[model samples]
Target: MFCSDDPVQLQLPVLETGFPYGELEELLSFLQSDNPTVSPNNSGSEGSNRTLSSPDDRKRRRMMSNRESARRSRWRKKKHLEDTTNELNQLGAENQELKSQLDYVASRFFAVQAENERLRSECASLSARLSDLHWILLAMQNHINPR
Candidate 1:
């Protein structure tokens, strides 16, 4: 009833505990005392009206606090999601780099295998040619020493 003329314009503080403990004592005193003051130059009717409006004021405070807490939780959730996204991106990049390194190692292994096979073939050919030369030398010695 204090702001009956401007009900839609009422603004409640968002925090429930933001009002000091001492202020609550003063408010209680005003409610219990024989004379209650509503506003400057206001009459008895407004003071009586405030008694009925007190419950509504308490409800408004509760609602405002709930809204503020909900807003903060949403912001925190968004930040967590953003952090997870960054981590996933970094892991994907690292995975790609590791894949490339594996490919490079595989290519090097194949090159070494090819080189080993070529060297083995060359050794086999050289060994065969050396055996043929030894046989010819033995045959010449026998012809020279026929006596």
Candidate 2:
């Protein structure tokens, strides 16, 4: 009986010696067969009686159920973590975009304010020049007509 963990060491000698093929085929089929005793679709009340017939069978069924439940729980947790990471990345990009827009709006607001100040200064200078012209015109009219 071969007890080594390496299958190549067992298979190489077995094949070279022309051993009985039927036993090898049976052993291979049994080793490869990993079908679960209870199918997930029929694990409810409908199949409970079969697993409950013997204490050993009940224990095995419970163990398999626990393993399946743990596998699903781990998968759900991994999916949730991935979803949270994606959402964080999306929100970060949106925040950066909003900051960029705010900066542009602020720059435009400052430029408009400076332009308004310049226009106000020019309007005051033009009003003062107009008032002086009006006074000069009045003096000219008085000199010409003596009124």
In terms of TM-score, which candidate is strongest? 2
**lDDT tens string, model 1, 1-147?**
553332233234535644466865554453345233345567777766777777776676677558656866887798899999999999999999999999999999999999999999999999999999999998999899986
lDDT of 2: 0.70
Clash count (model 2, backbone only):
0
lDDT of 2 by residue, 32-130 (tens): 342224544564774566556557655655785576568768888999999999999999999999999999999999999999999999999999999
- In model 1, residue pairs whose N, Cα or C atoms come closer than 3 Å (at least 3 residues apart or on different chains), thus clashing, are none
Cα misplacement distance, residue 63 of candidate 2 (Å): 2.4
Name every residue pair that clashes in candidate 2: none
Q: What TM value does model 2 have?
A: 0.58
At residue 82, what lDDT does model 2 achieve?
A: 100
Model 2 is weakest, by summed lDDT over 10 consecutive residues, at: 1-10
lDDT scores of the candidates, listed in order? 0.71, 0.70
